[model samples]
Target: MMAILIAMVFKLPVDSGERNGFALTVLLAYAVYLSIISENIPSTSVSVCYLSLYLAFVLFLAAMSVVLTIFVLRAHYGTGEIPKLLKILFNCTSRSKVDVEILEKTDVGEYEHEENKLTWQIVAVGMDTVFFYVYVVLISVVTSVLTVAYIIHYRSI
Candidate 1:
């Protein structure tokens, strides 16, 4: 996992096949871990520091991914389009007129607040592609380096 994130940080050009394989491997590893663990946690073996660090990293990654996604969507579509995209993604099972009406009304009311919040963020992160990539690369590198150091120091001993 650290290696893969480091590769991304360095802009290492992996072919799609290798990327797909790596993604598959990570997913399978997680699936196996969930299946074997049964309960929520080890309850005895995992150190608190490691568990907390891992959770923090996961949360950080999720947040970064969300912001990056919003940037991508912003680039391709205007602020007005997001509500439609969100509706499509979130309420795919819409089957009634009332639902559609409520969604539209909510979108109209929320657009102003969203627009104000989104403008600065999009400008801050969307200054240039380089800046966006740099943010991701820097965070990934920092986290991966810590994780690598921890593993080498504790596990390799």
Candidate 2:
């Protein structure tokens, strides 16, 4: 769980200049975690209800991270290098849907003249960063509180 959280932190552009690699590592870690849990469950007769809940939350986090990573990579590096299956799954396109003639006629020079103008790509990256932080914080807080509560409850009995 901590590894996943760390990997997520590392995925952010602020932490690591690259995100796709860290995201892939996190996904692999998640797969290993799931495999270990599955292997342990059959040998133990103990109740796994709480474990299942944790698993669900982790799985959700993993899925969200995967999606975020895909979007970030596509937005930054583009879809040209992405696999055909993944490109299809993500519905990625190499170029914008807007007509080339329209772009050619537009006053792109005027926009470039502005000193601090925000572009769509910058906005998208900003939004992605905000969402990533919020998701990580929310999951971490909830997991920590639940873990503490569970420990206290078990100790009382």
Query: 9-90 in candidate 1: lDDT tens per residue?
Result: 2132222224334434444544454445445666685555554455455445444444554444444345443354544433
Please list all clashing residue pairs in model 1, or write none if there are none: none
Best by lDDT: 2
- Candidate 2, 13-104: lDDT as tens digits: 63355565666666677777777877767656665556656766676676677677666555655433445564443334322331232346
Compared with the true structure, all predictions reach lDDT values of 0.44, 0.57
